[model samples]
Target chain A: MRNELNRVVMRFPSKSINEGLARSGAAAFASQLDPTLDELGDIRTAVSEAVTNAIVHGYKDEIGEVIMTMKLFEGDEIEIVISDKGCGIPDIDQARQPLYTTGGAERSGMGFTIMESFMDSLKIKSAEGKGTTVTMRKRLNTRRYR
Target chain B: MKLIHDMKGGLLTVRLEGELDHHCAMDITARICELIDALLPPRVRLDCSKMPFTDSSGIAVVMRSARAAQGIDSRFTVAGLCAQPMKVLRAAGVDRLVEIEEEVHI
Candidate 1:
């Protein structure tokens, strides 16, 4: 939030189907920077993971709202934060581990890994019984975007 | 998202278009499992070239398909993955497990 040049905030219900909505909304807002196809794809994937985490783990079976905030900073850096007021992660370190999935079966537990790989920085904050927030930042190598 | 299944020479290829996310993965997973169980093709191929975007849920789709194929003891291959699908598949080290018909360099 510090030294932010531009920003967008949106909130939606914690439904499984809203995963696509959140991803596309973030990608559409990022498109103003004219990011490359690969860059856009990375942004899309990262948002999808964050929103999915909110819906799948944060809310579990209950219904809630997911708040998404996007900020554009100098040097063409784009930052995104997905937050939820649902059950928070009890073990942040363990949950962030690659292949560590609380959602059994096909989850693959690669959500954070994919977000970390695609974005420049990924920060997770949570308090048990409170909520969890995930913030990701990436500097769009802006030469082409400019 | 839309899914199409085609059978040729005993090989069943599933072509996916549009975005694949948690929204549609459930039905896609069920359809994939059903197809594989019923047809029991010698080989199954997933076409991702036309896909615009895919996420971790898409990974679940692929895994479910692989499991379904395994249930029938059939070979499975992923073909024409580009952009998003390609990046995700590589990072999950899925290439180490499933066969990619086209070379996808991470």
Candidate 2:
């Protein structure tokens, strides 16, 4: 949200298959910061989690669009935002708790958990019936968590 | 996602390569189940050395795989995991139930 450095925005259908595209594209873009392999992998997994949530929880097999944006700050900081115009979470606190999932059978409920663990910062904004947005940030030059 | 399997009587070694996410978890699970049904390996080990990335869906598929093997009275283990997937599996609490081989690097 600071002074614009460089960014990429893309909108795609809320489909399961597009998750890979969203993740890989974001990883490729974030490579500009010269992130380590582990850092890149974490970023990829985090992006995948957010996009998958938009498709499974937000859209829920309904036709919708998931918008993603990646931006770079001057100090080796990268920010990613994934948004969806679909059903919003009524209880974000419960949703953030590990193993809390609406899709009981298939979902692991670790979507937000993984995103939170891998990224340095995570923020979620949502309104019932309006939409949800997940924003995560990380500094590439920081020491690796591993 | 690609799955390489070594079906030798009662032991099945499945090496999964590529990124496992929501996009391919279901299909991969189905395929692995198909092989399990046909081979009937008493012990199934998943080698994740080549699988560089995974998400919550990966956890789901792995848990399902573990359940599938248990349903057949077989042992299911995450044979090897690199750094990233290992961190995810541990955070998901899968390390408690599923047997994972240590010493795998990122």
Candidate 3:
């Protein structure tokens, strides 16, 4: 395990509007690591996907609390965890599959696929009626300057 | 998000400005579909040059737009996608569903 250098925890309502806030906040916090434009974009997109799942899938039609935790390690690595206490995923494998969604016609079902591709690693844990939690990690490329 | 539509000859071009996400996808998709259903143009084009950011929700917008255009027998094409949105679209294999062009001068 790398030494934990800094961390931030945010708690907000599981509203559709908060999706943008979550991703933008994640990008702002990740900027401390001096990530490049591509890295920042990847982080923002991954965060958006996870937060959207929590809001759209986890809580369903009801409003609940969505918690996000971001941690930075010694080696330019960042880890983000997004969790929601809502109706959990019945099948994690199926949910992770690309284009597989219960989110109706408006949903592309590509949330998990985008997150998995953009980040280095992804882990999801869920219980039928309990809740869902997603954790993702990525290490930015080392740069010569600063 | 802002949507600008230009209908010239048989082409209906809709320009998207601002971020496309779940928060705004519903309205955007509906507007585009409404336009397609009303105009029934021979060709439909989405200009994404000004759209700097998008999530999987953007995929839904694109897919819905494509479906709307298909309903009217209109050809659909997406042009001038920036890097991040393009990555998300390609990751979802959206290029296979609709015609994707890198840039458009006009």
Candidate 4:
């Protein structure tokens, strides 16, 4: 049996807006534990949504760095922290709403919703001038390797 | 994903083989849109039998595809959705927007 992997960190500038990079990073990180496609998809979606939110909403077309940190805990749960040093959400409540969008035409405001739906647990912190950080947790029950 | 189309009849069927996440959502969406616009299909069927997992981005892509089909006056139906994808669609209230075919035994 392979030992559970600990953590991975990746950083990308907001100007690039490459979805492939984020998803590939997620797949590679989760593949270390030999998770099933179902588990992998769940983690991939959460990471994608988080990275997208950081790029589109937090950075808001401005150039900044978005960092993603992923760590597996106790051979069962995965914790992920995605952060961006950009414009933060003034009103976190309104931002978390299902379809409430600050962006006029570019964003759909579904990033947080998708992240919450895919991950087991999600927490967000942001300040007016400071940046935003999103911490998400996902549990892996089955030991299937694929 | 394997997409089969009957151009003369204006019918397109898409068989999704694996998970539909951000990795494949854009590609699938672009392909579906191109086919629908190019052929002007009367109806489109999305077969999700083999698709075990789909994320919210996948749902967004599906919504976009459905909207594109509607814009062209084409009917779109999603069929053979298993547990995971079905739950995600239901949670997102996508069934109300698109016609989803339930399990049918032949």
The number of the candidate with the highest lDDT is 3
Classified by CAPRI criteria, candidate 2 counts as: medium
Q: Model 3 off-target regions past 4 Å?
A: none
- Pairs in steric clash, model 4: none
User: Which stretches of model 1 miss by more than 4 angstroms?
Assistant: A144-146, B103-106
Top-TM-score structure, candidate number: 3
DockQ for each of the predicted structures, in order?
A: 0.70, 0.75, 0.86, 0.20
DockQ of 4: 0.20
Comparing 2 and 3 on DockQ, the stronger one? 3
Q: Candidates' TM-scores?
A: 0.94, 0.91, 0.97, 0.74
lDDT of 2 by residue, B44-83 (tens): 8888888988888889989988888888899988866888
Candidate 3 lDDT (Cα, 0 to 1): 0.93
lDDT of 1: 0.87
lDDT of 3 by residue, A1-146 (tens): 99999999999999999988998889998988778899999999999999989988999989999999999999889999999999999999999988899986678999999999999999999998899999999998846454
Model 1, B32-105: lDDT tens digits are: 88888889899889888778788887788888799789888899988888767978988998888888877322
- Show the lowest summed lDDT stretch of 10 residues, model 2 chain B: B97-106
Please tell me the interface RMSD, in Å, for model 1: 1.3
Candidate 3: the clashing residue pairs are: none
Write candidate 2's Cα lDDT for A36-58 as tens digits. 88889889989999999999889
lDDT for every model? 0.87, 0.87, 0.93, 0.75
True contacts kept of each: 0.71, 0.80, 0.80, 0.10
